[model samples]
Target: MTEGGRRTAEPLPTEMELLADLSRLYKIQPATALWRAVEIREVLKAGLPTGRGLDLGCGDGALTGMILRYAGERPELDGLDYDHGEVRVAERRGVYRRTFCSGSEDMPLEDSSVDFVFSNSVLEHLTHLDATIAECARIIRPGGNLIATVPAPAFQTLLKAQGRTGAAREAYVTTMNARLAHKNYLDAAGWAALLSKHGFAGCSATPYFNRAQVERWEKLSAMTAGVLQKLGATNALLYRMQRLTRSDDRSAGGLLETNRGIARWSRHWARIVAGGVLDNPGTDDRYGCLLVSARKP
Candidate 1:
């Protein structure tokens, strides 16, 4: 992963800078996509491929374009995602040479077509990770790189459930996972094993986004999404209501982004963390996320 999180030749980005970039083009008032900037910066420092590459799970192609521009490398790239609407948006952006609207587990592409693949914060939410990883192994050429940013097991510990101990923390972790739609939160060794099982070798996982940074994101999430999760058992009515009422899936940025007041406040929050460092104090064993890298064998 770069030698260390903060030890790079490039200037460390402030929270406002990231927020501005995300919010700019009518996006985040400093949305949770701050996480994307965190992952992208570290990935850039680690050196990504600039040849035939794939942006796996690319959403709207905006973030992928941002990462490439930031890195000063314009690799010939193709994007893949399941959402037809999103794939249309990505196609309109002119970012990818080719775009596929398909699920990760069953991608529509040639074998060994790309030298490298980059996925940002996409793998953890998959219910079928093995299938997706196996597909990645198939598409990337031998010795080609597969780089991704994913949630680490430490992610649960880094949440705002700080003072809670034992079962309380465990419950919070479980509830948060349900609310966040996260299925896998593997550590370095677990990820290496999974990659190896799918014909990937030389796997390395570098955890990033330290405690304070993640806590800030969590607090922001809590304020916006609330503490209560709509886990279907008891809140079935509310869940059903939400499913019926929430039609803003096609909105820019997010569902809340369409709200005037919410957009204003979100922008305000984006500016509050002016000099917030992306990876402060550097990534340690306790960091919340991982930048995993591997090679097709």
Candidate 2:
């Protein structure tokens, strides 16, 4: 165990493995798919003369690479994560100019040093979320932007309702919370409040959840698996069942619809399955995630 009392039995993986895993999961070319709609490109296009940025919780440095490529000048980029194995992997991939093993609440970089700070699906994992937000405020130069995404609370609560009882429920909660230290799913109002408390200016958020898209994906995966099963494909059945079971499988009637109805108004279902869901456009009513952008005041 390390000094923090957490187990250290597993060493961090090299960057190659991290890239390989992401490539498989996203089912697209690396670098391209990972940063596609998160707007890292557009944000960089605005141009930071200083060419310095930080990628917090940069799992495998996928975003880190995109940031570097977008900057186009080999700007001073840093990537940090609590997992040393993942950091090592990033280092091996040549993704970040500098890579370190660090946590959200305790970044190693100096305060007010970076021109920009970006995190994708990262902030929610922090146990000390407020402290980390304060740290993000501190480290970013005045007027620098902090762009991030967080799971919408309504969808999470809906998942919880379906999760009802047993180990499955416990596992669901544990996984959701672990993803971003998501103490609770933050609605737009909740997110704006957090940003304002941290002295962030002009805080804006976009809802990105799509219940219909998620339902479609689930249905398609199920159908594909069924077809394979009919052809005597045992592995296909197992895979399809795994996906279906993992999805929020509660019927769309009674209590579940009521929960979804609440979710609709709160805009708590925006998600980043691969990247931003720009192809599907509708009001915030259908979104399940929140993409929040703010600046240090």
Candidate 3:
């Protein structure tokens, strides 16, 4: 049985295998990559139909590669990202049939052309949320699905509930907003309504990365990155190490032997354990992240 208590028709990648794939991105941001891998695994477990799918805001294309690994085959996928450097790296990864450097607010594709589309942690960063979702609705054909994982509004709630008050709360909010660069945060109902307004139907959302798990990620990420910086190690150095050592599925073990690798491994293990307990199937309505889906109608 899967973590959700549902029988898997085919097993998802072993945690190690998923980590190995994420090692491609761990070089970029170790803590973020590891935690996002958790959310990606949960989203892919839904087993959506894949054909000529587009990965909107596909940073480094690593998450899309993880989806392909989960499906056990490629499915005529293409990726889009606004960062020129990230797009170049994604092309080098060669996971997608093509990679484009363009904002999600305006896709270059024709309307009613794609089978499905998905994004991971992308929509929250865009200021023009309506324009972007409209573009997503425009490109997908009738009956095609838009599956994305986004930061839910409960993140803000949990942040406020941290017992800070007065100037402390203000400072915390300011720091988090600056650090996260999120332009949009909404609950499931808000997302469903937005999608419905843009020609989608059957909008549904499931929560993941509950409050406790999110807190762990924040604490562990700060601790790990802080230690690495104090030791004069940078994400650049870790990326180089990963590039040199990551040839296949065994990369996680190889990295675990080093100090930086240990930091990453610690974060990964903490995430897995915390997620298993807090974000398991049939959790409460509040979540740090929302895995949402809608169909073009």
Return the TM-score for candidate 3, rounded to 2 decimals. Answer: 0.77
Put down candidate 3 lDDT per residue, 1-297, tens digits, no spaces.
443422345777644455555644454354565567668777766665557889899866766776766664446878899977567768877888888889888898889888899888889989889999999999998889998888887776656425789888877766565456777888889998999899899998888876665665566555655456558766566445544433332423445335576556644553343444333443455678888889998
TM-score of each: 0.81, 0.59, 0.77
Clashes of 3: 0
Q: How accurate locally, in lDDT, is each candidate?
A: 0.72, 0.56, 0.70
- What does candidate 1's lDDT look like per residue over 1-297, in tens digits? 133332334654543465567654333323355666576667766767768988999977877776666554468999999877678778888989999999999989889999998898899989889999999998999989999999888888778774777899888778778766799889999999999999889999887887777787776656544433433333443333332322233433345545677556545655564345553664444888899999887
Residue-level lDDT of model 2, residues 25-139, one tens digit each, is 2332222222233333333433333458787888666555644543434556788889765676677667678888988887888989898777767776567889888988989
Tell how far residue 10 is off in model 2, in angstroms: 42
Supply the global lDDT for candidate 2: 0.56
Error of 3 at 214 (Å): 0.8
lDDT order of candidates, top first: 1, 3, 2
List residue ranges in candidate 3 displaced over 4 A.
Answer: 1-9, 13-24, 27-30, 160-163, 224-285
Error of 1 at 188 (Å): 0.8
- Please give the lDDT score for candidate 3: 0.70
Candidate with maximal lDDT = 1
